[model samples]
Target: MIVIDEIYISDEVVEEQFVCDLNKCKGGCCVDGDAGAPLTNEELNEVINGYEKIKHLITAEGRKIVETEGFYHYDQEFGWVTPTISNGMCAYGIVDEKGIVKCAFEQQYYAGELKWKKPISCHLYPIKISKSKNTEQQYVNYEPRDPMCNPGCVNGQKLKVPVYVFLKEAIIRKYGEDFYEVLSQIADQYYASKEAKK
Candidate 1:
């Protein structure tokens, strides 16, 4: 692990490669999970603030759910998360003609409607951030998993894009540019040290 200030980064974040292949996964991460995308207090406010602008992009059923249940719901395991429809699809999700589910917030963000793209947690997929127990330190870990995200992992390997690099923008969004600069330097040295051992 590489420690920078209060953040503890998993070595796999610098070693493993990952790039989301939406065609293969069909944006399964938005629909297949037991819980909705995790949300922070700030993100919750953003959703509430931007709901009106992006509400039209959601599915009819999803919009109804959001209307009745509000933007978020409480999950015992996940704390505050996006509400889900009967099929477990996120309330902020809409399937395209290709049958790939996409986030409404991101769609609106790209369309120049919203300032933020989506929840930071959703933006930073394959890299989960959680606070260490009984401490103020935050852990940044690579979270590539099987079946759903396997295509992304494979593509990332083929493209030689490390997890940290693939999620560069989101990392910077969450932890600022300076933090990422230091992380890049540390990753370079980390890889060099590994090569030296060989």
Candidate 2:
């Protein structure tokens, strides 16, 4: 782990490779989870307030579920999460003809209908964050979900794209550009040390 201030970062973020192959995984991360995408207090409000805009993009049943049960519900493990459809798909999910699940909010964002570009957690896939048990610190770890992300991992290796590089925008959005810059430097030095030994 690389300790920088209150954040504990996993080495795999800089060492391992990953790039989402949506065609292969069909956006499994969106629909395969136990709960809907993890949401912060702010994100929850954004979803609730922006529901009307996102409504049309989602399935009709999903819209009904969100309307009746509210946008988010309490989860024992994840606290408040976006509500899911009966089959466990996100209420905000829109499956294309190809069966690839996509975020409705993102579709709106790309279409210039919404400003918020989906949730931070959704943006930071493959990189999971948890609060440290000992301290009020955040541990950023690379969580590789095999098979679901196997193609992404293989493609990343082929493309030579590290997790940090793949998730640069999300990391910056969560931790600021200064943190990202420092983290990049740390990654650079770590790789340089390995190269020197080689």
Candidate 3:
């Protein structure tokens, strides 16, 4: 484990490889999950406030789910989460012509319609962050979602991209550039030490 401040990062985060293969996975991560995308308290407010701006991008069914169930709901396991449509796709999810699912919030974010891109949990996918009940420390674990993430794993292996490198933008966005720099340095040393042993 790599300890940085209050965060405890698992070795897999720096050792394992992953790069989302959207074409191969067809964005299954957005639709295959049993529950909707998890949201923080602040993110709930952001989704509520920004929904109107991105509503046009959502499908009619998605809008209906959101309009009837509200922007989010409480989950026993995931706490606050976005509501899923009848088809199990997130209410904020949009399907492109290619049948690939996408996040409406992300679409709006890139279009400059919203400042917040999407939920941080969604942004840092495959790397789940959970806090310890006994301590104030947060654990960051690399947990790829079974078959849904298989294509990404294969792609990452082919590209030789570590999970941390593949998720650099999200890491920097969540933990700042300084944290990412330190992580990169640590990862370099970790790999170098392994190479030396070999």
Score candidate 3 by TM-score against the native: 0.96
Q: Estimate candidate 2's alpha-carbon lDDT, on a 0 to 1 scale.
A: 0.91
What 10-residue stretch in candidate 1 is worst by lDDT?
A: 139-148
lDDT of 3 by residue, 70-186 (tens): 999999888999998888889899999999999999999899899999988889998999888899899999999888999999999999999999899999988999999999999
TM-score: which is higher, 1 or 2? 2
* TM-score for each model: 0.95, 0.96, 0.96
lDDT of 2 by residue, 66-143 (tens): 989998988888778888888888999999999999999999989988899898989999898888667889999999
Error in Å for residue 53 of model 1 = 1.2
Write candidate 1's Cα lDDT for 157-182 as tens digits: 99989899999999999999999999
> For this target, which candidate reaches the highest lDDT against the unseen true structure?
3
Q: Which stretches of candidate 1 lie over 4 Å from their true place?
A: 195-198
Per-residue error (Å), model 1, residue 1: 1.1
Task: Please give the TM-score that candidate 2 achieves against the real structure.
Answer: 0.96
lDDT of 2 at 112: 89
User: For every model in order, what is the number of clashing pairs?
Assistant: 0, 0, 0
- What C-alpha lDDT does candidate 1 achieve relative to the native structure? 0.91
